[model samples]
Target: MKFPTVRHCWTAFLLLLASGLSAKEVPPPPDPPRLVNDFVGLLSRTESQALENKLVAYDDSTSTQIAIVIERSLEGDDIFDYSFRLAEAWGIGRKGKDNGILIYIAFEDRQIWIQTGSGAEGFLPDVMAKRIIDNIIVPAFRQQAYFQGLDRATDAIMQLGSGEFEPEGLGKKKISAARVIFFIVLLIVLFILLSRMGGGGGGGYYRGGRYDRGGGWIWWG
Candidate 1:
């Protein structure tokens, strides 16, 4: 039997090193006991049970899954990537619907990520996700109200997912449109009253001989 060559030994050494690195970097996915996984001990027993019950009821009613995971650290991994991996590994949502949301909080890393599965993206887009974190979760977290933040954020997600109400931004847009329409109508009414007050002579208009209306400019005769 011929001994292994120097190149063969070096190649084997490199392969072993690569395998070890891979094992270290890519840790095994978490096996959560329930929908709420407080690996970091952020939530108390009562809080965890309350959150889990809410999540379970929401899933039962709508068939959409929402999971909350609080970890002490991400082990230097990117929060977004790690959260996505966790969601995939756990299969949080139904198989075909894929309507799942993962709320991941890393205490040491000081990061929060909301990962929505494909089917749930319509209800919870990236912008809305950021809004939930920035507007809802972060504020409560700043006050050290972890459970409150998680509760409110999850409530918002469930409401949006179930179509109980429009997303905040979308709702704001609708309100804005309604305001614009009201303002336009008010302007039209004011213009008509002013025109009547001027008494019959159409030559003297608000601005030259043209009126800038909603759709386009109208030449006033």
Candidate 2:
């Protein structure tokens, strides 16, 4: 076979180089299913519903968007880099405000990233994001309580956006249903005690020879 000319060889080399450069490949684009996208099925239906409600409500009120993504793997990409790429590709926050928040979880890599938009950066700085992961998320992930971790972390993030969250309170661990129920019961008991103490002073404890206002012995005593 005859050898190729210099111009032909140069063209072939350039083409090959261009193809190799293109083949290097960028991160994949994001196609979010909804406000909460659980690709890995980490969240049950109920958990998903709870997060959706919280996110929807926050968005409705503040026009700030938040989304969750759970993936089995990041396809060998770094989670932090993948998170930024996904957030940018998804166009999550408002165009002008840039108030979007992304909660990205890669279970296979045991990595979590809280990606915030320009508006959110004021509330959720990189330092705060790391703290949320370390204090709120990693502990629950360690215990396999992904739902609790996400729920509380979302709440804390929302509180941050609202400017009501105290950095000192980050130390508080996840609150359990049982603890909530106990708090409700304790409040109810306190309310009853206060009501009994009031004892309807308009009419004395004993009126018209009957306990008109305070029927209980404790109230009278």
Using TM-score as the measure, the top candidate is 1
- Report the Cα lDDT for residue 2, model 1: 16
Where is model 1 more than 4 Å wrong at Cα?
A: 1-33, 166-170, 175-221
Residue-level lDDT of model 2, residues 26-95, one tens digit each, is 3344444477888788889999988998898888899888888888776655454456557766777877
Off by over 4 Å in 2: 1-33, 167-221
Q: TM-score of every model?
A: 0.65, 0.62
Worst 10 residues of 1 by lDDT: 211-220
- Positional deviation of residue 187's Cα in model 2 after best superposition, in angstroms: 50
- TM-score attained by model 2: 0.62
lDDT per prediction? 0.71, 0.69
Candidate 2: Cα lDDT at 140? 84
